[model samples]
Target: MSDATAPQPFNKEIPTDEEGKFRGYAKARADFLHVRLVVAACGALIIYIPHSWHFALITVIAVCLAEALDTISLNQSIKRLNSGAPLRPELRFSLYTAAFQALLFSGVVIGGAILQPRVTIDMFLICYLFAAVMNAGMLLYFNSAATYLRLLIYGITMILIISMRWMYFAGAPVLAYETAATLLLAYIAFRVIDFVENNFREQEQDKVNALSRQKSMKTQLEVYANKERHLLQLAAVAKHANDSVIVFDKTGRITWVNDAFTEITEYPRDEAIGRRAGTILNGPMTSPETVAKIEHAAATHSPLRIEIQYYTKSGDPIWVETNLVPLPSSPEMDGGMIAIERNITNSKLRQSELANAMRNAERSERAKSEFLATTSHEIRTPMNSIVGLTDLLSEHDLDPAAREYVVALQDSAQSLVRIVNDILDLSKLEAGKLKITPSVFEPGHFFNKLDNLMRPRAEAKGLSLSIDLPDDLPLLYADEGRIRQILVNLIDNAIKFTRSGGVTVAVQGARIANTCRFSVDVTDSGIGISESGMRRLFGYYAQAEDTTSQKYGGTGLGLAISRHLAREMGGDLTAVSHEGQGSCFSLFLPIACTDQSLEGIEEVTQIPEAPTANLAERTILVAEDNATNRMLMSKFLEKCGAEIVFAEDGQQAVDLFCAKQPDLILMDMQMPIFDGVEATSRIRALDAPQPYIVALTANAQKDDRDRCLKSGMDDFLTKPVRKVELLDTIYKVLADRPMMEKPLS
Candidate 1:
């Protein structure tokens, strides 16, 4: 918490008057010396006045007694001032000293009157008045205020003395002396009055200046009070806030802490206060770099924002964001820092989760791309042999049993193509690159399509497949392609996993909401997922069981893609299953409301079938780098009754084509001398009849195909060639050639 008290002023030296007790003693001794000198001067003046020896002696004794008493009072006053007590003792002593001196003077006057009976009383009276005036002046010198009061008191004494003098000397020669003495005394009184008046005026002006300064200070203090109140309110709010707040001095001491700080650090304010901030809060896990940064900020008076790991009171490490600021007003004062710490442990954990998600996404993408490339190569390799051999077999008269076996082979090949295309579609959907094309269609038609697609697979698995569509179901305005993809993936997963149970897809609800939800539940009696497996069931490439790779074969991306698509369509896909029990997968889709009549949904056309015929009369050239692939192509093509010529690389193929004039060339990419792309370019540049060129390369990436096309190849073919794709491509290229230059003739 922020400190509430204002800093004390910096004092360098002590005042001389308040230095020590000994100074007070020195002051008292100085006053005593002055009083003694005054006494001696009075004695000398009395001796010159021609008084009797006894009178003079008595006068000396009186003066001596007065001085002694005054000295004692002064000493007492100094002692009281030094002791730091009230001025009562000093004032009382001063008053007593004044009284004593007054009595002494009165005695002198009375004694003179009694001893000098021959001497007119007027002379004695004049001498007494003079002594009174002198005493009053001495009183004024001793203490200013006391002196003024004494002067007034003694002025009345002088008046009484004058009255006595006038009565006694009215018929005596001493009247002249009395008159002179009275004039001088009156003048002295006048002077004392003038001096006192001036002194009083000076003191009054000093009082006015003092009051002015005090009033200005009061105004400033009022402003300060308002500001302090505001700051106090702010401090209270900061102290009560949920975030832990701590203030540290420039020396790194924990000067203040809020309630929240105590709650977080588990250290009470009393225990934390005056302790070093680092010693209490820092632990082994705390970074040295963070500590260095805090020190740098304090030393340089810079504000800093940093995130650090700090141990809580329970010794648990928690992440905190600390905002440190410097107080710049007082460099000499301690506690110049404001530290506010907020718990960010949850946020850090969330950030970690997101980072892991991104990494997983990247890995999934790489896997999909790899799968596509590998599958392309795998499907096409055998396809070339099948299609080529089938063409060769078509040329011969074959038994009916042989024909049936060939047909089966063709069916299996087509199935593989369909599976590859499905995988590709799922990959596109997962990548968010699949486009949606919405159309008005009957919900029944959608179900029928699903029935047709999955009925065969279900029959193969010896499982029943059913669909439930309410007659009242309205037309759904949704992307037919996406909806079909979702159904296909879910039903396929059900069929693949279920050994005996049937798969059911049900559709319901077409009300005022202008939408319909189709629930596709595929229940299987096969092995169900475990609780731990369910956690990652919807994750990409995560199978339902640990041995899924051995027991069931799948890309594991089906459910993941289905869920993503379902969500994109403003619906969701969920699953419920238990170990050893059947699993139910449901897909919910929002119905589309439209006034138009539902029409039959169109399906994409299947690949055209190739005519079975032998190309033995035609001559073909094989250009390949890999020896195994080259031999495979040679054997397969020769079995079709075609005369075959081989080239180890692209450059050889180009040279052989110019000499042999073969009907076609199967080019391989990644060769030792020259690759397929270069060979194709060189072949097209030749003056001779350009052989029907087809790229048969392992570089199956999309960019690779574009490059092959740009090189003037008639067609692009990925490696591990399929029999059907190779033959179909050959026929297409040959069909487009000019008949006048037909090499087979």
Candidate 2:
């Protein structure tokens, strides 16, 4: 639909040929009708005669009727043309109607001239006819046939009026001049019409060309509109995205950037655009290699993703992960690039901090390990002397008070060693380095031995200790040492807290398939722990109460180490108790059962009171750095019936072995003039009888033991080396080797 007020611009949608011609005719007729009655009245008045009002009135009526008829014809023609009717018939009708209107107007002029034949009036009438022809030609020129037909009617009427006047009033000479002038005027009118017709044809051709151009422009506009819509959508996404988006030319000059880009760089859009990204974002700390990688990717028209350090507008350094992609070539921009970048400053900082923390943790662990090793060696050197001398003292016929003191000294020394051992065990467990070596052993015998060991402590506290073991025990495949350690810790805690009530060790076993589940309950009528205390009971160095350590004298590490050991052996330790009643600590273990019997074993329900330390006719060499330990070892070996040769350091010990070829060597690992490991290596390298070498050191870490064995030592022991342990090692070695009866020198 077209706007009624605004003229419609020419386009293909409008039928430019027939429709335009029809509209032109309609419009011209409307314009002629607006003034037709006025023109008729003025002409009648201009040629007024007495009682000639009716003539004027008739002319007006006739003009009105002609206008109404022309309008009806025009409307019908327009409808037919809109219905796709042929243009030639409508144009011919238009020519006929226009000629009729021209004839009516020419009759008015010729009638006025005949009624009032003054030469001036006649000349005025001739001029009016000429004007009317010119007006008709101007209006109807869109249809050349209509314009020419109207022009011919008015031309013939003017020439007929001129000839009639000349024949009535003037001579033949005057007639010739008038006729010639009228023909000249006709010629001019025809020339004007021809000019207008030619111009209309040119204008119509221009309108067709304009219509074609307008169609092409409309297609281009639609394409541009679609492209603009896509661009707007892309802009909206980039504007709100979290990552920075940037577009730059092949020369690395930024052409566009999104809001995120400006926010990340702390640069405004106007300042950021038209500048090289590297110039603004890259800083002194930025890696040269990373920059080179980006440059190479860009130069090769390839995509790349990299993390690089960049500086903001304020010169603060940050890290970003950038994805650089090449843009497809376009006419407006031949080769360009777009970069999507994410800020990773916080992540990078966290990585750096984590790395630093890991390095620090490793260093701390190493330091802790070294400190423990050194402290163990330093403390145990004197502890060995204390325990050994106490054992030697007990052998004498001493008074009861002296014996009590010696026993106390021995207990204190043992307690110190337990604390050191607990600390080391906890460290190993926490460091994930504790080794659990499984072995086949009789569960009955194992519990019986633990019962024997803990009974003495129970009796000393005036508390009776009892062990209830299942009669049908399986040969359990498990880490016996670790299990015994946990039980010992549990029983020790039980007896330690109990004053009057006794402690009981109850063992229940269930066998299914090849696995045996054991529940060893160490219950005691002792001071029970509160719920809060139970919560932290298995934490490192945590006890039942704050004053528990002060009152009971413990390192508070036993239960923690015990629980760790139990779990390491595929088991768990739990406890249930009520305050003021008692606590029952249960040890659960899933040990694989074996059908095979214990090899080379005796079914001793109770451990022997003592190990037979008979080393008669044996020559032993002791290498020690500490003088007290050396004296202690000498007294212990001599008391065990073995002849002792002493050395102050590793070098002297090796010399003594070369000379005497002692049957056994007690090598103090951390000694002067190279440690026991080097001394043992040197002694083992000798082309002589190899002495049984036992490593004695307080560095109780498993690595120390492995290292000692690796250095050719026959056995490894952690101090404080009990006199019994030293003598047992010597006796076992002699028994195994069947030493020759070398005299006591």
Best by TM-score: 2
lDDT tens digits, residue span 699-733, model 2: 77889999899999988888877777666566656
| Candidate lDDT values, in order | 0.67, 0.78
Q: Can you give the lDDT of residue 661 in candidate 1? A: 82
Across 1-745, the per-residue lDDT of candidate 1 in tens digits comes to 0000111111122112222322332243344445554654354345325666655765766656665666566666677776796665566666666666555655555455544444655454555455555544532322444445555555665566555555655677666676777878778856864675455445555656777789999988998998899889989889899888888876778888899888777889999999977787789989999999988988888999998887777888788899998876655565478889888889999999999998998898788787786676566555645655554565567898887666556545544554565566566665666666777776666677678868877886689988887888776677877778777777777777787878777666656666565565666676778999899999876787779967776657767877887888788989999988878888777767766644333332233466556665576788876565666676556556667888987778887887778777888766768788888888888787767777787555655678888998777776445656676676666555552244342
Residue 614 lDDT, candidate 2, scale 0-100: 67
